[model samples]
Target chain A: MSGNMNLTLKIWRQKNNKAKGELVNYKVADISPDMSFLEMFDVLNEQLITKGDEPVAFDHDCREGICGICSMHINGRPHGPKHGITTCQLHMRSFKDGDTIVVEPWRAQAFPVIKDLAVDRSAFDRIIAAGGYVSVNTGNAQDGNTLPVPKTDADMAFAAAACIGCGACVAACKNASAMLFVSAKVNQLAHLPQGQPERMERVRAMVAQMDKEGFGSCTNTGACEAECPKEISLVNIAAMNRDYLRANLLDSEG
Target chain B: MGVFSFLLKSSIGKKIIMGLTGLFLIIFLVVHCGVNALIFMNDGGVLFNEAAEFMATNILIRTMEIVLFLGILVHIFQGLYLVFENKKARPVSYAMTNGNANSKWYSRSMGLLGTLLLIFLIIHLRHFWYVSRLTNELNANETLFDEMKEVFSLLWVVMVYLLGMISLSYHLMHGFQSAFQTLGWNHKKYTPIISAIGFCYSIIIPLIFSIMPIAFYLGWIK
Candidate 1:
């Protein structure tokens, strides 16, 4: 109880996709600053269960920040007040003693709230399925030395491949645009020799699916890059734009 | 959809159109400001009048004027469409949003600033373009410079012009480099140069435009 803090929480509580949601208030005491944000939620849920009340529902997997499932729009930000982090990676220490926190689900037409702080981000799955991969016949792996990808391209491709498929970029963007997420997927593939066969078609099909998902258009505001947990650069977006343009104008296979 | 329809309907395609038209308008601003600065010569508007006469009568300039109008129309309509779609993307609004945490206020407020500029454009066209080109209201020997002087003389009109210029400044601040980025021109080597040029352009061009109204109203140029 020495450094433990008591806090107030305003959390969005929604029943289901069709139901309306409201921010319900609660209180927690003796919260240790060392606990991860999700652990803090675990404590809250335990408290609710003791009181015979329904616990707040949220999404989480691999609290180590990789699975990209943890999502909480906390205190008017995607993953609390931290930069370049997922909600699971945030710790209770980020808050001051006796602070009031607000948490909500990602609000976008393409990402509907499932319950409480969880949203249905299957839209990203559909986009990936559209063309976020390269097709190759089932055979032995090709020799890595055979295709000598330049150092610069490999580095850029690796950087872009770091995207965790989190919807934080959409949550941070004013337009709720999924450009950062979609572009990351596009650039990761487009930079490698393995992606050359379907580079043009991938950009075209992925963009079409992204638009169909009702996500807003990118305005080059850079919010997505600023808020990305993996620190994915906005350059991915520019590259995707370039690829999409070439696909539309120059690609003869269209 | 075919390529043409894709260009018209796709989200990225719409943005490309916005970027292209925005760059065109940015160039037009430079030319417009350069020509308007001729008033500083203070040669009884003689040089300014000659330049205005040539701009009015030159066949190439006349044709480009039509193209310029079309660009403006496309930019405005496309911008409005994007704003509408963006709003719909998040129909269930957040209870609290701190947009300033990740992006600049002007970058987030492009639609609002652009709307203000549209209002300014209407007043601007009526004051100068309509009087000199579309109407016979000006007597013989009255130049476009005369109309500017008469218009800027009004305190309210001068205030409106100054407000318009401020809005234009913020719009360009976000728009100039944004146009380049949307066009996929972002490069580590060239983007910094583009951003630097954009920053200077956003300030210098709008400053020049603001000075025209202030100079006329304060009797600095007359």
Candidate 2:
């Protein structure tokens, strides 16, 4: 309380996708430096509700950075100027006493705004539905070492599997493409022995779903991986490409 | 429904369509650039013009043109669709954030650059294709070299060509790398190399294409 600081907040407010929204300003005081950015917002929201005003709406879950649900463009940067942490994991100490924080949702034509600080992320689920799953059966409850997958393949699969299905890749992409996300999923499946059974079919289905989901084509801009909280490599994207090519060529020839 | 749905519904299906169409267009550009480069090869404009004329009338080439048009349409449509759905799918966020510092500039701006490239394509086809078909059709005696020079002599034409090439380059910057990723060639060891290749191709192709018009206009070629 002795070192508590006052901060200015400019936040986006919209009723829904079709409604107009503007950044509303507010002043918050006595905030702890150890408070997370979302915690700071929580304090602000508590005050607003006590004043009988509608609380600001935002999306957050599993604040630990695993759910891929936290996304905010703070002061013009995604995830609030952090290197690899989500908004929930971001603490107040990153800012000073008098700093002005501007908060907004992911802005893109594909990501039509649903409400203030909330956009529809079901596009990702649909993309996954298009072909993100592995249908191969390798027998359950058996020894993990039975398959004898190469360590290299296992490592790559682990990395690719790290994707949390966040729309950050889409938000970060200039074309608003989800190629990185889709390719990660595809590569995760393609790298392991289990993934080999339906490798070609998997890539074919996933890429098709990504396209159907209205994501833009990849432009080789490594923005997705750079913004990825998990730091998933672009190597997965290339691997997805090789498999996709082989699948297409084989599909056509055979 | 099958064709339309296949384009809209299937990820690999969409990519295959996209890749095939893109590859075809790339082939066209390479050959077009190669033919234009002929001015540097021959002492006069004779070789390039003859080649252009033959290409314009050849039955095989004519068939390929129809395929090319279809490919362009599919590519554009699918690309647009993907952008739309990607937005719709990710409707909510868990928290507020900012820029993706790790990704490539081309990947993020592909759609915007692509829109620019589309406009450029229309203008380019109109100027080069329609004009060549109607007015310049009878200029068989004029070498492709002379015709290109005449076209490039206009400052506006040079600007348009330059802009067109730049857009194409931007498109390639993303398109090349993206196509590979969708196919699952994402090995950590090879990705950087592939991205480098994509960058180089994007820059070189446009640089070469843009130079041809400028060279023809500057009297760099006979």
Candidate 3:
């Protein structure tokens, strides 16, 4: 598995959502198995560049899987076949010689293809703008231990905060539901003491924005968690739902 | 939008309706299955008829029938909307799809299962409910159990009922706990217990329902 091998790549080629896309084929020979998946793409791009041809356009940064910019649909699953890892963390060794890999961009309407393998993930940004943060004035720093937060609650909030704003959940979902992504933000704050003041309003507004963005309803298929690079738990969704219900009840009363 | 419209408009809002309506229908199934199971007494439908009469004539239960109909309509309506939205979400088709790895087949095929169940429900209601309550085809003193016997006498009808129950079990397998999850009832200590109860309910309730038709068709009831 550690030897140089030849592989065929069937990548999607679309200038934009308006333009039709097709699977464009390329062959890369003598690839090192130790090379990262994006490195392999780099080699392909280098070849295309030397030949005076257009290089394949895709998104990547912080190849450490943290930035979440390297979003792609490899084969069928998001961020390639391996679980709990981003496309940048994917190595060539996972694939074998002569493997004809099919690569494509996220296909959700909410994440329309921007280029070949990059999608317009601005919908995620819009949802965050709706209310993904606590309202706090910045001045002299408040002590971190001022609230005396519970360790477990802090950890759970950290877990929910691990969402990188990647659109993978939308891509993997059968319904293209953004419940996992929205819930991550919702539950992250739902667990913290500081988040209590705007808890109801945050959940309600974010969900409103998510719906307005044209994402479909979640059916609790659990595919989002299975495909998420951060391994975000489905329990976050339950937390969001709980908050949402209470928020609705309160809103209706007021 | 206002609060109620807001709840009904969002993706999560639509799911809330699906969950709430699904849970409501599940309660109906439990009561229906429990009463239907009474045929096992085999006392020539005397006790079963008494129970059926109480259900049909009781003001409280009669009022609930309207509520149940509304629940079913909302459930079906929201289900269809969710299905359409999901399909539109993924307009570009995958060249090769593998669904088994991520979720159960029943979980993804809920729309198909629900559609089949809708067809079955109409036929079922027409046979017993309409005949028993709406029409004078049977005397007031006549037992509904005898109607069940006559209905299950047909092999095709029994097969339809069994198939409907299969769809129901699969639908409930996902719907039972999914409803709870959508309503945000999932928890660390309680989720496992809820899932186990849902699994058992999905299997046992459908088994009870299918058994009634099977028992009648096979002469086991006699």
Highest DockQ against the true fold, candidate: 1
TM-score of 2: 0.77
lDDT of 1 at A162: 93
Error of 3 at B205 (Å): 0.6
> How would you encode candidate 2's per-residue C-alpha lDDT over A122-194 as one tens digit per residue?
8778767776776655677559787788888889899888888777777776557787788788888788777
Runs in model 3 deviating more than 4 A are A138-141, A251-254, B1-3, B140-142
Ranking by TM-score: 1, 3, 2
Q: Per-residue lDDT tens digits of candidate 3, residues B1-222?
A: 565775666777788889888989999988998887889998877788889989988999999999999999999988987899889877887665556767788888899999999999999999998998888887655668778899999999999999999999999999898999999998899999999999999999999888898899889987
Ranking by DockQ: 1, 3, 2
Report residue A136 deviation for candidate 2 (angstroms).
Answer: 11
Clashes of each: 0, 77, 0
Candidate 1 vs. true structure, TM-score? 0.98
lDDT of 2 by residue, B81-184 (tens): 76665445445432444444455455556667777888888877776777776575556465445556777889888888898788789778777766666555
- What's the TM-score of each model vs. the native? 0.98, 0.77, 0.95
**Docking band of candidate 2:** acceptable
CA deviation > 4 Å runs, candidate 2: A1-5, A14-22, A30-32, A49-63, A67-69, A105-144, A165-167, A170-222, A237-254, B1-8, B53-62, B80-105, B134-137
Compared with the true structure, what per-residue lDDT tens digits does model 3 show for residues A79-159?
A: 888889999999999999899999988878788888888889999999999999888854575697777879988898999
